[model samples]
Target: MHKQSVFSFISQLIWVYILLFSAVSFSQKLTSGFKHTNALINETSPYLLQHAHNLVNWQPWSEAAFEQAKSQNKLVIVSIGYSSCHWCHVMEEETFSQEDVAQVMNENFINIKVDREERPDVDQVYMTAVQLIQGRVGWPLNVIVLPNGKPLYGGTYQTKTDWIKLLNSLSKTYKEQPEKTTEFANRIAAGIQEKNEFGTEKGSVFFSKELLNTNITTLKENWDLTYGGLKGQQKFMLPANINFLLDYVILSNDAQAKKYIKLSLNNMALRGVYDHVEGGFFRYSVDTKWQLPHFEKMLYDNAQLLSVYANAYKVFKNPLYKERIEETYQFLNTIFKSKKR
Candidate 1:
């Protein structure tokens, strides 16, 4: 062979060696008895990076995933979770890591994992569905949907065996009971559509002065003065509602409403739900006393509550409320600034 032919042969040999070495390296890196064809390597998200080598042929939440599911007539299994959640990690190891479970999921459904912390809007919509379906919701929420993104069924985490059984059952149901599936999906879709369309009409209707006063009176009647927040075991620091109360107090010269607003803000700021160390509020309290929190501190919640505290300081001339507002701002600047992208 001439010099040029020898060089060409050498280049071809090098390419073949590179390909074979890469295949061996990949095989060695994968967990025993689990192999997948995912192309999500080097992704930055901690949650997505964790699943980069999962046994399931996972696709990112994309138009392609939905389109493929539609073309294949497959149900879309949307698994929503966050990185820090312990149960989310457990479910991944137990079910998503199993080769057989992954095979069933890949074959029968379009599995899509969503990082709830990354895309809260998606989480909120499906979480609402899960709540509607089961009358409660939690992390690692799972929803099964039709090709058009209409949720057909929803629940929380399942063990490997249970998930496999559920997948098998759902696959059979989808294949054999098409009309029944469509009927269930349509009912949910119509209900959700109507709820979304009508849910905000209350504010529109109660825009009048007398209606507003009446609503304020009704809300104050249920206020938990002893606990210093709204009346509930699951206490949410509803800043909007608080602001409405403040407005009512100012307009109607209601001393009780103003007193309730101050008490609620002070109690929430002093409670464990406020993240005294970190200086941002948790999602909400699980108990009536505002002691135990759900522990997911969201950006929007912190921003809104920060403003509320700042306004409270302006109204009451309280240094503690002003300090809380500054601390919340600092927390946002430190944590959220890093995660903005």
Candidate 2:
């Protein structure tokens, strides 16, 4: 036990050292063939590092960034996305890298790039507002807000032309008709506040097996037998859904449930989406049978999956489950240790 604790201590120290070195490496601006530098140069997030040399005046989400917008009476352009997001990278290359689009964004909007993993609270608030307006929310989530910090307009990835058009239109609408824009902001803010009013919501008086059984029944209804996930896998949230079912399996001890769990685990681990070359999972399997994949290695995905597999190993002492947990841990400990503040 003491040896295990010592090994853990050394492992953590090594991780810390790696993160510190990485932060220092990312601090230097990459100057090869870049159009210009921006405020993102001062940021620590790996996602922000990817945008440090963009022509857009990209600032990390901060009190100072918002204050600068307020003082200049400029609208805020909050772009929230994570490091491993494919669409976010696409938008960066297509729109933010373009000279014309960057000029408009810099001139009219205080553009802020947020790592959603780093600031989920900020993401939650603005994403809620985006959902309120657009009826959905997604990565590369671009939200335009008033100088006073109320959301005005929000959308996911737009074409370069469309983004330029949006920047111009919102700037115009905001300047020329302050009253209309203010009304819109007020309405959106109110809606966001209302949706967020879950503070007073009652919790269950007590836990019950009946409630668990009901949820398990819902799971059974949703289960895709052709594929292993709860639903047909255009995308897979295996860690969240499968991990929960694992607890249900242990609690119920249903023979069928155990078989299903094993089936799901084996398919996910053996599938192309599981990253045979790498030690982590792709974001999801694009195909229903987990053949094709969306290859983005998210920290949360690997982190949650590590827990799920680790728990599975603990219970069943399965060699496959143990191997998965070890591999996933290695992947996360190596790649996701960014120096984001």
Candidate 3:
């Protein structure tokens, strides 16, 4: 080879080696955090093990923690989150990992950490309250409950400063205003009882075709045609409404309604929310175009979305919709089906 050609060949070889080394370095960094240990070392779930060594005296979800709070006459702080949650990890590092914050928590509150996945019953009860109280719900839920387990306040992740201030303020209020706290708790308990009583009695309303049309119009107002689906970023399927749209389009032969339904389904199916590698829909899309996912797949969401897509296919005779239905079914069969029996 000519001298210049030989030099060029050597340069290409060096570039290839550099690329390989960079790849290995990135992989090492990703795995390096895996070596750290926490109080969760012996815990059953990988999520719990990930938090084993935090400064906060973290206790697993147990009756003992609740009992201790009651006996100590301390308020209970229940922090609920899952492993895949990015905010959960941030809160742990910023708030739970701080010595002063942990000190305040240890001195004034009986803190309990719960993996929402492991104890979904607990998560549901509190999450319901979070929605009722805050008019919304999300991960890294922080709820402060009375000794008797009645939640007084709830919020999502907080900055270290905000969390510390809130904890101190609550502690002071609980200490100085015992009578007021009792009165407030009694009112909340009564409200819950009244709500339960009301929920038990179902009132039936006569439905008409007009009412159905009104619902479809309302959904259309929220629909996003440019990116597909309804609402802004952090898009959810709203399967109930989608099924209604499918029914409306088939019954009324409305082309515009059918177009919107197709747009929503195709956007979700093609985006990261569909989990191209894993073959199941994620919890929700974090972006307007449904390109990024929160990555926690729920069985219920899959089941509901599967039914919607299957119905769409049955009505439209569209192979694309049929393919989505089949793929979702296969995911359920392969991942969720149990052989325990």
| TM-score to true structure, per model | 0.73, 0.71, 0.75
Clashing residue pairs for model 2: none
Off by over 4 Å in 1: 1-44, 53-57, 67-73, 84-87, 93-108, 116-139, 155-173, 195-206, 217-222, 231-233, 335-341
> lDDT tens digits, residues 1-341, model 2?
69999999999999999999987776543554566888787777999989988889888888898899989999999999988789999999998998899889888889889999899998888989989898977799889988777899999989999989888998998889989999989999999888878565788666687887887888788776665776753858567777777787777787767777777777888888788775888888888887788888777778888888887777678898888777877777766666572
Ranking by lDDT: 2, 1, 3
- Report clashes for each candidate as comma-separated counts: 0, 0, 5
Cα-based lDDT for every prediction:
0.83, 0.83, 0.82
TM-score of predicted structure 2: 0.71
Winner by lDDT: 2
Give the top-scoring candidate (TM-score): 3
Which lDDT value does model 1 have at 178?
82
CA shift of 111, model 2, Å: 1.8
* After superposition, candidate 2 runs with Cα above 4 Å error: 1-34, 42-46, 62-64, 71-73, 82-85, 115-121, 131-138, 168-180, 194-222, 230-233, 252-260, 313-319, 329-341
